[model samples]
Target chain A: MKVITIVLQIGFLYVFYITGSLLQRLFHLPIPGSIIGLFLLFIVLLLKVFPATWIETGSAFLLDYLSLLFVPATTGVMNYFDLFAGHTIWLFIITMISTLIVMIFSGHTSRLLARYREKRREGTECQQSLSESSL
Target chain B: MSTVLIGIVFISLTVFIYLFMTRLYHRFYIPFLIPALTSTVAVVFLLIIMEVSYDTYMIGGQWIDALLGPAIVALAYPLYNQRHLLLKNLYPILGGVVVGSLTGIFSGLLLAQSLGFNEKLLFSLLPKSVTTPVAMQIADGVGGLPALSVLFVMTAGFTGVVVGPYILYWFRLDSPLAKGMAFGSASHAIGTAKAIEYGDYTTSVSSVAMTLSAIACSVFGSLVVLVFYA
Candidate 1:
């Protein structure tokens, strides 16, 4: 029973994958087919076209082992080991600095916006209180 | 043994080493001891010392690599689970991700270009802010070496996970939403792991931010590529 259910879940995912690939080929999309497939799955789930239970188990199982799948590609970096020789320090510095910059700017912007909304609400509340007191 | 058998052996060996190292990392609780980074480094060294060709290693490695697509597609489940939170906080989430992703790309490209890195390297570095699967796709779409982009994304992930908390505290940004966006936008999944340390709210928000950034990149990242390569 478990095995059959898992197979059905995989079948559902494969359908989305095929849909994504077909769309990409027809439209010449720059995005990866798998991501397009993800969007398809997301939309279907959003609209209740497919019950989440249909794919949840299989997706959870796959995602659970997701990091394992990356090992091969992570090891593929060896092919470019020579590229790292001259640029290792530079690459490290650039990635570190850029990530830091991203964190700072994104966090700062979100916080600033949050603070602004809070202040506006507070201002409106103050005005309401003042008018009630005057009355 | 046949090459195919050898490849399978290598895969098992790598998985064993990775799992072992992860347990060690958890026991010790050291940032630099990340299982992925440490295992990659160790395996690379082992291969070099043993005179095993990378192609030989990849015989098994490619099998694992192929799963990246499905694994990435499965991300939709988690994203779907958090859909309501995403919609509720859509404005700030979108605002932070768009700005952060653009900031990541521009900063990496300009810095590399100024330092005289080749165009290929520039393309590889462009998607450093995203998760590995999405990063690889964006890199390949933009004519970069997908393998090289993996390296860059891992570095970005490591750096973001390590330095992200300090940066957040340094800037005095305490909101869960802000913290989550910062990690998800800058580092992707590994950073999201760091965000999870805070609470469920931060984790869900980080997941939404990471998902948003991937969609934004897939849609607009190509435009950045077209501007350069076209």
Candidate 2:
């Protein structure tokens, strides 16, 4: 069953592999092929073509090791040593500062929306209290 | 003849590297990618400085890189598993991705433009905030260097890890699902992992969002780029 499970999981990966090539050839889509495969799986599941276990094991294995997939790209960063050296101070300054800005803004924006919702909720409660007191 | 022996030696070495990275990550509370990336860079750079060609490095590395295709396929399983929860928050998920992606691209581009960066660098900088593969593809398609996109991606991932949660928490997005999905959609796989760490509820939703956004990117991200070209 273990081998069978692994085989099924790997088989699913093959489906995605083929989808990648398909999207490339047919649509000339700028998207990667694997992403198309993912969409196919989404559609299939939404339609209930498979059981939950089929979904669970395969998904867990992939997501758990997803970081490992970027090994090549991560190493590929080294090729940019010259780019970094060119504006070491400037690029570092820009990247570092900008990343913090992105972080702070996105965090606060989401938090603000949540807070605004809470304030609105509190306002309704206060109004309800006043109406009850009037009675 | 000796290539096979070297190949075996290389495989074991890569495993050792992975194991070493895993241990370092566990012990130090650093993110996993940092070690994986740093070690790969350190090892590869040593090889390069020692006069080894990229092809030789790739000989070992490709074994690792080959898994990327399969890993992407794995993204969907999470989506499938989280179907019920996703159906509940589908609108927010899509809204967050579109808003987050466009805002990220726009801000990065505008910031560079305001700073008076040249056109080529500006074009390269536009997609820096997206995930690596998608970002790299966008960069390459528009005649920017794929390499720069990769750098942008790593930098983005590093930034996401450092600053993503603070923003999520700051916004009081205490709903683990919302926090995770936002990070996953905006930041991609690396961000998704961090999202998962935030909580199970968020991790599950974020995993779903991360996978979908990649699909969304192919559909939407291209259109955005096309507008620039047209």
TM match of model 1 to true structure: 0.82
Candidate 1 structure quality by residue, lDDT tens digits, A79-129: 777867765569768988999999899887777776777788899999999
Give the per-residue lDDT digits (tens) of candidate 2, residues A46-119: 78887657756656665666666566557665555788875433544455445445444443344455456668
Q: State the lDDT at B172 in candidate 2.
A: 63
* iRMSD for each candidate structure, in the order shown: 2.5, 3.1
lDDT of each: 0.78, 0.63
**Candidate 1 lDDT over residue span B1-230, tens digit each:** 79889988898878888888778878987667767677777788888899988889988778776666665667677778877766767777778888888888889989989998888888888888888767887888888888878888888887877777778888986888898989888888767656656665676677667777877776667787778657
lDDT of 2 at B212: 55
The CAPRI category of model 1 is: medium
Q: lDDT score of model 2?
A: 0.63
- C-alpha DockQ of every model: 0.56, 0.40
Worst 10 residues of 1 chain B by lDDT: B192-201
Q: Give the clashing pairs for model 1.
A: none
Residue B144, model 2: lDDT of 65
Residue B161 error, candidate 1, Å = 2.6
